[model samples]
Target: MFHVFCLGFLCCSMVFGILLPVYESYKAVKTKDVRQYLRWMMYWIVFGLFMCAETFTDIFLGFWFPFYYEIKVAAVFWLLSPTTKGSSFLYRKFVHPAFEKREPEIDEMISQTKERGYNTIVNFGSRSVAYATQVILQTAVKCLKT
Candidate 1:
């Protein structure tokens, strides 16, 4: 019974999350209006964060809380609600400020990570080629001997 209720709430959240965004996105494209685009951007950022949190917490608290899905769906609705404009409020009050403060640090970390990843991939590629060449040469020598 609890699982069934959770499923229903999940379906409702999906409908709100997917359908409403697509509709708003189409309007944004058709109108080519900056405000509409900004509104959707705010919605996406909050919704995305909510999804990441839900994914991590659901395993631990999903079944424990009876109101979990109910709250999840409600939160999604709040984020997308035009009258409430919860997303914009949250972004302005919290998300934007936090990100703005950390932007430089984040940029530096990202650059370092990218450089490390590139170096690792290059090292792996060179090592793989060398190993392959060694195997090929050894096989050729063995075949020639036989």
Candidate 2:
């Protein structure tokens, strides 16, 4: 039971960390919000962290057995579904959703970019392989040259 849950959790983490970011980048390009992809990726990281914490605690508390841990999974999933890193996990899930308050989704970001103009930007994906690999290769080559 735990194994299955763990598998699902692992998949979610991979999607949020990797697949989702790539998708966000595509979304940003399509929406003409060059920086919004990075922002969305940041939100994914925040959500992944929250899911890890909540699920970890529930598993730690020994509350994830017999009933298949639906409550814990649902609680964590719903909490992390929002697109914001502003609120803490618990508040964002158990509280924020109640008020129908949404974190900035990629669509909202694209809209903002359309309405206004791009001024401030964040590289949210500087650590991405495509971005980081060039520097890594350069450093390796420099060391070889030395």
Candidate 3:
């Protein structure tokens, strides 16, 4: 029924949006052409943002929009179309400009996150080792008593 259409739409989107683009990106990388590589990199950045937005839209508004899948498929096709260069257009118009404006703030946030993540991991590791040692010691003592 409706679910079948959604599944088909997603499959088509995946083929055009992800799989084919990935192959093209690989070829672009192998050729060592900066222009082609940059083009595909733009596509990847735009596609990533598209996916994040789509996840929320699909969760909140998908059922309400009867033509959702069709529109999604068309959008993916547009993004991948060489003639349109939609991905490049979007990156230049939106993503690049926004990121450029916020790059410093973004970098600061990333640096703080990395520091916190490292500290958290170190803390977790030490706690885990301590717990394991305690458990082992307790088990050994119990076994010896028996």
Model 1 residue runs over 4 Å out of place are: none
Tens digit of per-residue lDDT, candidate 3, span 1-146: 77987998889988999999999999999999899998999999999999999999999878898788889899998888999999999999999999999999999999999999999999999999999999999999999999
Q: Who wins the TM-score comparison?
A: 3
Across 1-146, the per-residue lDDT of candidate 2 in tens digits comes to: 66686677567656654566568668877898845755555455555666567666665654435544455445434533545344245445554464345555756978988656533323345446666899899999999999
- TM per prediction: 0.90, 0.35, 0.95
**Clashes in predicted model 2:** 0
**lDDT scores of the candidates, listed in order:** 0.89, 0.58, 0.93
lDDT order, best first, reads 3, 1, 2
Error of 3 at 112 (Å): 1.3
Clashing pairs in 3: none
lDDT of 3: 0.93
Q: Report residue 16 deviation for candidate 3 (angstroms).
A: 0.7
Candidate 3: residue 145 Cα off by (Å): 1.8
When summed lDDT is taken over every stretch of 10 residues in candidate 2, the lowest stretch is 118-127
Q: Candidate 1 on 1-73: residue-level lDDT in tens?
A: 8888778877887789878798988899799999999999888888888889889889998889768878888
